[model samples]
Target: MRLRVEFTTEPFDLDEAPAHALAAREVIETAELDAVDVGPFGNTAEGSTDGVLEAVDTLLRKSLEAGATRISLQVSVIGDGNGEGGR
Candidate 1:
């Protein structure tokens, strides 16, 4: 099954979102993620459901650590589970 996962956290400035995205990209470095869509960050991103979820979760935590005033994020994903490894 595929999941269209989404969530809203605190609000963050657009300029700072890229930094968060860059950091979040590292999450894929040691995982089983098939790919990383090298675009979008901050309040948004697009990728496999699992990868997007993991990155959002990590970015939220990191944003808090970085003293981000408000880091709100939402994700809309689409996938076909029967088409495994197709993300």
Candidate 2:
């Protein structure tokens, strides 16, 4: 299966990106994912089930350790890995 993940780390810093946000970006950028989009307000990535899951694990741990008081996340099965809808 293929998955897409969207996430945001809270305690926002208006002046600059917070440590937690930076950590999350690093996790997604280095993971085996595609269509990565990291921004001040949110971030998203897509990849295989295993890859996305692994990245999520790392992202949560690192972001929290970096001082995120809250995190908003969503995951969806985008495809079946064979070009079929994820029905």
Top of the candidates by TM-score: 2
> What's model 1's overall lDDT?
0.48
For residues 58-77, what per-residue lDDT tens digits would candidate 2 score against the true structure? 99999999999999999999
- Residue 42, candidate 2: alpha-carbon lDDT: 88
Error of 2 at 50 (Å): 0.4
Q: Against the true structure, what is each candidate's TM-score? A: 0.46, 0.96
The lowest-lDDT stretch of 10 consecutive residues in candidate 2 is 78-87
The candidate 1 region of ten consecutive residues with least summed lDDT is: 35-44
